[model samples]
Target: MQAVYSLPTDVSLASHGLGGFDELPSVDVIVPSFNEDPRTLSECLASIAGQEYGGRLQVYLVDDGSENREALRLVHEAFARDPRFNILLLPQNVGKRKAQIAAIRRSAGDMVLNVDSDTILASDVIRKLVPKMQDAAVGAAMGQLTARNRNDSWLTRLIDMEYWLACNEERAAQARFGAVMCCCGPCVMYRR
Candidate 1:
């Protein structure tokens, strides 16, 4: 993926307390949705709203032409109270990649967090991920992901195991070489 802006390499972690999170930069979260289940989307939004990051943060929810009116209404109602939440409703159905690109173009943050509509993040996710971007050479950082419905079925449990292996083992090996090939789409942070 291409980065939209240059990252600073001179940031120091010593001044700020633990992880230098007090120096967190502005962040914009881009969420792309196309016919997503309303309940799942609500949970995802709630998770984002509950983030404890002290830095400036905004959410851009892109609706890629969802046919379900109820889903659209749910999104509007759930996020209506927050001024930081912005909704972009495309006139026609667009693919996820295109939707994300559109949001990225409009984003005004120092870093962008691209999250899937179905994923729910931990409250400190951004706090943990932002520190990785302090290294100018690192263009992106990704968070660990497990099936949100892992207990719903045996298949989901198997998928959760796969996710663990991918995030813990494979990605860890790649990080040692500074050559991670793919960032998990469920939750990822990028410089600009």
Candidate 2:
């Protein structure tokens, strides 16, 4: 069987410089959605817009044949004016992979960030992630998840623990050698 390779990008004790990279690569963020909650989607897009990375960042918001296209209008209205955010509306609903492909085929960002519609990122996420991908041998990188409601309930606490183990222990160990077991889909980065 094929196992996925995923690990967190180590930004701990990060230096102010670009980790020896001559120039930071441009990044394209592909977000696929199908009738996603407008609130969550808005938050996700807002996070991307708020990235502190100093490179060119383009966001592709793809509507993957949502039964209610209007659900996306709220988000569209929020980000439509931002030149970096492009909305792609598909007439029919394809799977997530296909929706991502639509943007992949057209985007020219040296790095591609495949983020789920509901995922929200920290302001420094892309800034920290880019330096790791600057290494020539590195093909992809995964970011850790932070549960905004980790203390809200037992389930949230359990999930938070799982994320810590999966990202910090398991994935971090494997990532030392450019090997990861499985990347979390919500916020994985790739080199194009």
Candidate 3:
């Protein structure tokens, strides 16, 4: 495979013997799963696969020794149809942080976006986040992460409200001062 080089900003593509980037950015998303809910996992992958960014994007499903081997197989088979989807299965169950580090280590893009198996993303999520990486001091960029629980159960509703508030208010405020402490694994895009 040929090495992919970053486009030079000073020179236009026509003058550099190239055409255009076609909206594609060099970004990679890593999702770590441990006995993840198949329905939710599928939704997460679907959202990623539906990304509108023309840049090369890949979703890495890091399976941390899921006990349900059959479900794992099914998920692997589902994503195997596309070149952009990849599965990295570990022999034993590892904690989320370890799995996250492993995913980061295996990633090959200029930036790495870490997300959970249950989270879904908008098509333009990466497009908006990737641009933030241009700043050297900005180690990471995170966005609103509202939960999509349709259930009317009290606990579920309460959790949704808390999550919504965190994403909308707290996170938004932290973003302004660049004091965002937590990475919020759901929709965080990080510079590699």
lDDT (Cα atoms) of all candidates against the true structure = 0.78, 0.80, 0.71
Q: What C-alpha lDDT, on a 0 to 100 scale, does residue 81 get in candidate 2?
A: 94
Residue pair clashes in candidate 3: 24-54, 24-55, 25-55
Candidate 1 lDDT over 1-97, as tens digits, reads: 1101111222223433535334568999999988887877887888889887888999999989989856568676669679889888898888999
Q: Write the per-residue lDDT of candidate 2 for residues 19-101, one digit (tens) a residue.
A: 55666778999999888878878888988898887789999999998987787787787798999999999999989999999
Full candidate order by lDDT, most accurate first: 2, 1, 3
Q: TM-scores, in order shown?
A: 0.86, 0.86, 0.80
Question: Which ten residues in a row are the worst by lDDT in model 1?
Answer: 1-10
Residue pairs with colliding backbones in model 2 are: 4-181
TM-score of 1: 0.86
For this target, which candidate reaches the highest lDDT against the unseen true structure?
2
RMSD over all Cα atoms, model 3 = 8.5
- Minimum summed lDDT over a 10-residue window in model 2 is located at 1-10
TM-score of 3: 0.80
Local distance difference test, candidate 3: 0.71
